[model samples]
Each structure stands twice: as structure tokens, then as C-alpha cells.
Target: MDNAKLQQHAIAAECFVEVPFFDLDPMHIVWHGNYVKYFEQARCELLRKIQYDYPQMKASGYYWPIVDMRLKYIKPAKFGDKLLCVATFKEFENRLKIDYVIQSASSGEKLCKGYTVQVAVTTTDFEMQLVSPPILGQQLHQFIQAQ
Candidate 1:
């Protein structure tokens, strides 16, 4: 399936955030990098709901760090603006991928969309994973089945 279609497999999380002063730049707009944190927040929430959060990942003897990230800005978000952030699981196998969408809460204007890719590494030898651990695959399968 294409990326658009894979969105169906997504486990989503939504959050409301007020753009902080520190997140803004000299032009008084939220910096691009801060969006990555927003995506992380939403994605972690989704993972936790399935009992597979970061701590569980470490306990499972694997480390999954973001290896790829992409973002498209559609509009600017200003400091103090309340916005909604949505993140969805996009893929899980050799890696975990998530897609994100950000929008202005009051105007409902689309602000940005992005995706992040994280690959698992064996904690013992630091070897990269060729396929996802059963723990993740099984949880994803169960989530899909329930949906």
C-alpha cells in the first residue's frame, strides 16, 4: 500500500498546546524544530496506550531512535496560539514510523504535516534490527485486529 493508504494502520493521539515564548524565534513564530517535540509527545501517548512505551522498549533490550524525519509547513503558528497536534502510527516492521498533522485550534487552519522513522537496535551488541521485535509486531497486529 502507498503511504496515504498506510494511514489506516495509524494509532492516533491528539493534544492541545499553547505555543510557548521559547518556542518562538526572532520573527515571533514557533521554530520548526519544536514541532518535532510535539510529534514525539503525541506518538509516545499512542505507544503507551498499547503498553509499549520507551521504558518498555529499553526493558525489551532494544533502542529505537529516530533516524529519519520529514516536515512540510503549510502555515505559521505564533507564540501563544493554541493548536492541536495529531500523530499516527504509519509503519512497524523493521522500523517504527509515525505521521503528524498540526492545526490551529481556533481557526482550524492546517499548519504542518510530518513523519518520523525510528529503527530498533539490539541493546547487547548495538546491532540494527532487520525486522521488528515480536513485542511490537504482536501489539500492532492486535491493535489492527481490534480496529
Candidate 2:
């Protein structure tokens, strides 16, 4: 809950995705469901930077499933528009919480923002981990230490 610790331990990263024609609805704006995909792309990049991505999670004997997610749209994006999605680590204890901001890559105006929380489960027995696995803190610590 401490701001200092959160800031110090945060995993901050940004990734770019272009809105393709296929992602657009008839109105020419990106479909609402596609925003989750945008968040996923950025989340994967951030997690991969910390070696905590899906494959790594499986290798570490854990499976993390998204337990919650929310998105609020501020603007609509059209085809061929480049957007920046920034993912930041917010919490990791009983669950992993990550926040995301999607913005116009050129204008820097926020298009939407959201958060996702994932809980870990054992890969062997499929038992939910009440708290994150050891590797979570280890990777986070290493990332902070490196910074």
C-alpha cells in the first residue's frame, strides 16, 4: 500500500499496436472486445521483460488466470491508428495486479485505461495459490535491484 514501495517495485513498460482494419467495427472504431487484446499485448511484453510471461509461468509450475479486469474508454481509435499501451505493475501478493493505459501513439491522448488481476494455481494439481508463487517476488526483486 505504500506508494514508495509500489513505485520502486513497479514494472513499467510500453508497447505499440496498430489498429488494423479487421479490428474495427462498421463505425470504423475499434471493437470494444479488441481493447482487451491491446491490453494483453502490452501485458505480455511487460511480463516477458520480467521473465514472468505465460510460458515462464508454466515452466515454473504455475498457471495464472485472469481473475478480474476493467476497461474505461476515453476515446475511439480507427483503422491504421497507432496506439501505445503502457503496463505497470501494481501489486503481487495474494494476486497479481497490473494497470494499463492505452493512448494515441502520436497525440498522447488516452484512448482507454484498465487493470487486470491474475491469480496463480499449481500446474500439477490445479490448486489455486492463495498467494503468488515464490518466483513472482524473486523476479520482481531482481527487476527492482537491476533498476
Candidate 3:
């Protein structure tokens, strides 16, 4: 991955999530699909940190929708496991891309890694935007520069 660019424009946030009993599968580990929910939780926190969360995105007349996502699960998380989910901003000029890491909060062991790509679209016309709107790029620029 582009670690240099990531460090240059890094925006990240972390959240704790305890694996719930309901999330476990019949085999006693968390279901694969549940990882996406955990990623969303962390992503929401990351967006809020940049002050461009879903509400703000809609209010700005653009809708940001995830167009791509990928996940690599390395370890299984069992019920009651304390997991730390981290979301990091990766790109913002053309589209929004965020990388995610979910790991054991106690051991710092990585359990999964993933990235999500979202593109901006006009809310009124539902037109896909080839490039992200200025609002997003501007906010990310100011946030990164301030950091």
C-alpha cells in the first residue's frame, strides 16, 4: 500500500467493539458478514472526525455511496472478544477511499483488514461524480493540513 501518501494525508479513528453473542455463528466464531458492520462503525467515527459524516454529506447536496469494498480476515473473533476497529482515510481527490483494520484490543493482534471506496453523486439528480466534490476534498485538505 501507499504508506507515504497515507502518512502525508492521514485521517484515522478507532472504536472498541465487543463481539456480541448474537454475532457468533453456529460454529462459535463471528460470522464473516459481521465484519462489515464493525467496519461501518469505525468508518462512521472516521467521517465524524473529519466533520463530513453522512448527514453533512447529504446536507452538502452530495451522496457518498460505497462502490467497492474488500476484506481479508486473518483471525477469528469469538463472542465477548474485545476488538478495536480502526479506519484510516486513504484518498479524497477523485473518490473517497478508506482503509480499515480490526484487531484484538487486548493483544493488538490484527484480525482483519479491508478498504472501502465511495464516490460522490449528486443527490438531486443521482448523477455519479467522476471526481469528489470540493466540499469533501476541501474538508479533507483542511483537516490534514491542520493535523
Local accuracy by lDDT, each model: 0.84, 0.90, 0.91
TM-score, candidate number 2: 0.94
Using TM-score as the measure, what is the rank order of every candidate, best first?
2, 3, 1
Give the per-residue lDDT digits (tens) of candidate 2, residues 35-104: 9999999999989888789999999999999989999999999999999999998888778899999999
State which candidate has the highest TM-score: 2
lDDT of 3 by residue, 13-79 (tens): 9999999999999999999999999999999999998799999999999999899999999999999
Model 1, stretches more than 4 Å misplaced? 1-9, 145-147
lDDT of 1 by residue, 19-122 (tens): 99999988899998898888887788888866788999999999998899999999889989998998888787667888889999898899999999999998
In model 3, what lDDT does residue 83 have? 99
Clashing pairs in 1: none
Model 2 scores what on Cα lDDT?
0.90
Q: How do the predictions measure up, each by TM-score?
A: 0.89, 0.94, 0.94
